[model samples]
Target chain A: MKITIIGSGNAATVLAKLCVQQGHSIVQIISRNEEKGKNLAQNFNAQYIPLNGTVNKNIEIVLVAITDSVFPKALDGLNFGSIPVFHTGGAVSMNVLRNTTTNYGVLYPLQSLSAEVEEIPTIPFLIEANSENSFKILNEFANTLSNNVTKVLEFKRLRLHAAAAIANNFTNYLYTCAKTYCDNEELDFNLLKPLILETANRIQNNDPEKVQTGPAKRQDVYTLGKHLQLFSEYPKLRTLYTRMTESIMHG
Target chain B: MKITIIGSGNAATVLAKLCVQQGHSIVQIISRNEEKGKNLAQNFNAQYIPLNGTVNKNIEIVLVAITDSVFPKALDGLNFGSIPVFHTGGAVSMNVLRNTTTNYGVLYPLQSLSAEVEEIPTIPFLIEANSENSFKILNEFANTLSNNVTKVLEFKRLRLHAAAAIANNFTNYLYTCAKTYCDNEELDFNLLKPLILETANRIQNNDPEKVQTGPAKRQDVYTLGKHLQLFSEYPKLRTLYTRMTESIMHG
Candidate 1:
């Protein structure tokens, strides 16, 4: 497949690398900035083109891997000449591509991605298309890059995206808060690493609520109160601790 | 070391297994129930003694691996004849053993433990003692079971305990909430496993605050609001989502 990848950011870079490694040709690299565009193009052995520049008509798929804010204006004054165009985003609706081209789709990776990672782990790709033919093409292309691919439509995909936010983003925030508390007390944050890994590993084989063990889950009010008092220095964390404990205890 | 292990729960079971594997003699297994006590005792080829029964006077150390609530009453009226005694708990203070015996200490494993797990991973032990002699013995015993051991004091240990609650228990609760939301939508919870593993793995090498991603950290009010709206069907999760988002953004 001859692919043209747009945007020069983390998701874009990772997707481009996956495509090139999988024996697909990256026909062009498009970005608003010429320097980043040229750099990514050189790294992937593709040609550089500005966002407003002409997209190659010979390409098979044009992938837009830009941020949500930039996604709306992604195809402004651009033409793919009936080539299948796919935007990789979780929140945006598939209808946004209705005006871009007759053949448009979405290829959202269900993972918290980072460009610093050299090898992309096996990420589940959630895909959608406006038509069956486009869906088949996009799904086949996605399978080439990842084994875990699902052809979910827009509404269910959005709900899954929201759940992913809570699971990945909210949990990482708690980790940040925990590390902050450890730092303030002059304790080694390193000590909490094994517990964190074990906690995550437990959920692999059991329901998280059933396997929950701690001051909050066991209703150890004495220890919970002590933790609250400790978090008095940070009002936000104190509030968070109270709310989450109540949720766990009551729900 | 001639060791007598008290209780038959997760901590006690793991500790007994570790001691036996290290070629230490389990002099006795003490519990209120004869069945569980004898079961554990027979597993290690040690004598089973009821909580009120006479303990062997020749034992070198008595380890109380019981719940925090029952820890206060664990050694009441039981004479150890100056044998070094230790309890494994995180939130507990070393002073709890002050009235129990003259030679008392703490041997806490800083990891989420389960009785169902057959093999214990390399867990970091947090040890404290009333005196230097007790500390040396406990440290050596702890080193036999685990490579990572720290002699953390009561105050700092309490802080670490609170941080562990947030990192392990609170995050598992968040995972439970996320899984609940996914189940309601008829989505496969298996899709979350890879992301959960990757999120936990990232913190092993980087500062969690620096590597934190998602709508809450980005302060993307639009996606956050959408998630809040989705959670309106479940009031508890809705409240949790709002509080966590605020904490991540403001803290």
Candidate 2:
């Protein structure tokens, strides 16, 4: 299958490399920045196109991997003829490309990706299309890259996007907050790593509710009050701590 | 080493199994509940003693793995004599046992334990003692069960405990919240498993801040507002959604 990648971000570069490794032909790589476009295109021996130039219609699939804010603007200028175009966005809908082409879909890789790090290929892909034929094409395309692929509708995908925020994004923020607190107090954060790993592994076999343990969960009000007093300096953290504890206790 | 476990909870069971596996002699397994004490004692081929009975003073080490609320009451009744007793608690200081016995210490396993689940041997134990001799003994004892053992002070251990809450307990709560939301909505929570596992694995290799994503990090107010609106039925969840998003955006 001949593929043309749009954008040169982490997702675009990763997808390009994976597609090439899977024996799919990457005909072209497009990016607003010449250096980024050249970098990815050179890796796959594909043509590099600037944003101002027209897209090559010979490519079977066009994957737009640009930032969500720029997705609309990028689609406004894209002319892929009748070729199917898919955007790798969790929040954005498949209908965003409705005016651009008849065959449009979504190819959302449900993992936080980074260009500097090696990609983990086992992450699931959430795919959606405007029509059954387009869904089939996009599904096949994703199936070639990953064994874990789901054809989720827009509403369910939105719910998943929200859940992902709570589970992944918000959880990581909590870790960052903890690290910040430790660093400020000149403490070692490494001691918490074992507990972190164990907590994550527990959910593989048991519900988190059954495994919950902490001062708040135990309703140790004295210790909770002490922790709350310590959080006076970090009002936002204090609020979060209080609210989360209350939720866990009552839920 | 001659050991006497003072409780028959998850921590007690895990520590007893590990000690028995290491070929150490468990002198007795004591519990407030006679049945639980007998069951745990049978596993290690040790004697089972009810709380009303006296503990044998010949034991070198006595580990109290009871709940925080019962620690004071339990310690008041136990006779440590010249035996070194340690409580397996992260937040509680060694001073909690100061009035109960002259020889007291702490041996906290920084992992969430479950009686039904098989224990992982590679857990980190935070050891503390009121005196140098007690510290040495606790260190030597922890060495037999786990390779990752550190002598931590009360303040540092408290910080570590708080950090563990963020990384382990709090993270698990997030997973629970997400699972509940998915279940209530009739969505397949299994689809999020890959995302959850990858999120945990990513922190092993990189700083969480650098790999952060989702609506809050991306500042996608539109999608966030939609989510909050969707969560209107769940007041607690809606509040959590708003608070977490605000923290991430502002912090």
Candidate 3:
């Protein structure tokens, strides 16, 4: 496939690399930033085009990996001439690309990615399309890029996005809270590393509900009170501790 | 060292295995449940004693892995003759064992353990002792069992315990919430596995606060509001989403 990637960011760079490594040609690199655009294009031996420049009609597909705020409009004034277009944002709806081309949908990788990583880990790409033909094209292309590809439509995208936020963002926030507490209490945050790793490992094979273990789950009110008291000085943490404990108890 | 363990639970079983692996002798297995106690003792060719039975005077040390509820009273009138005693619990203070014996402290593994696992992962042992001599003895034994051992005092144990609960229990709850959301929405929870694993892997080398990304951290109000709206029907999850979003926003 002859691909054109618009946006020179982390997701864009990584996806472009994947496409090239999988025997696909990146025909052009389009971006608002000239330096990054040229540098990325230089690596691919592809044409470097400004955001408002003409997109090659010869390209088989277009990958839109820009910011959500400037999306839809960012792909403006450029012509891909009925070539398939795919946006890499998770939150945006597929209909947002309705005006861009005849065949357009979402081609988002469902993992936090960094371009600087020496070896990019396998990312589960969530592909959604407008029609059956477009779905087939996008799904086939996605499978070439990743082994873990799933079709998530617009209806379930936001809900799944929110759940991903809880699983990744909220849990990382909990870790941040715990690390802050350890720092303040003069405890080594390193001590909790093994427990953190085990929690992640255990969930791989077991349901989180079944493997749940703690004071709140066991209704150890004494330990729960003691934990709450320790966080009294930090009211925000105290409330979070209380609310989460209640959530688990009721769960 | 000749050891006598006063429990037949998961922690007790794992700890006994560790002691035996390190060439220590399990002099006896003591528990209120005779069947489990005798069964555990049979594995080591050691005596099985009732919870109220006499402590073997020749045993070098006694390990207490009992529940917090029945503690202190459970040890009432039992005599250990000042041989170093250790309790394996996180939320407990070293002072809790002060009433039971003259030389007693904590010998807790920071990671959650299950006896059924064929190979136990390395657990970071957190040791707290009443005296310098006791600390040395406990730390030495802990070193033989685990490569990761730390000297956490009573002042910091409770705070560390709360942090561990947040790192393990609260994070696992978040995973459960995400999985439940996926199940209700008719989405495959397996798709989020790589994302979950990446979040855990990212935190190993980077600070959680530093690597924090998502709508909450980015102040992407549009996506945050969309997430909250999707979670509105589930009030508890909605509130949790709001609280966590606020936490990341203000963090």
lDDT of 2: 0.81
Candidate 3 chain B lDDT trough over 10 residues, lowest sum: B112-121
lDDT of 3 by residue, B2-102 (tens): 99998887788888988999999999998998888999999988899897787687987889987655676667777676788899878876676776678
Best by DockQ: 1
Model 1: CA > 4 A from native: A33-39, B25-27, B33-39, B42-47
The stretch of ten residues in a row with the least summed lDDT in candidate 2 chain A is A114-123
Q: Name the 10 consecutive residues with the lowest summed lDDT in model 1 chain B.
A: B113-122
Off by over 4 Å in 2: A33-38, A42-44, B99-101, B119-121
Clashing pairs in 3: none
Chain B structural similarity (TM-score) per candidate: 0.91, 0.91, 0.86
TM-score of chain A of each: 0.92, 0.89, 0.86
Question: Which lDDT values do the candidates have, in the order given?
Answer: 0.85, 0.81, 0.85
Give the local distance difference test score of model 3.
0.85
CAPRI-style quality class for the chain A–B interface of candidate 3:
medium
Candidate 1 positional error at B30, Å = 2.3
Pairs with steric clashes in candidate 2 = none
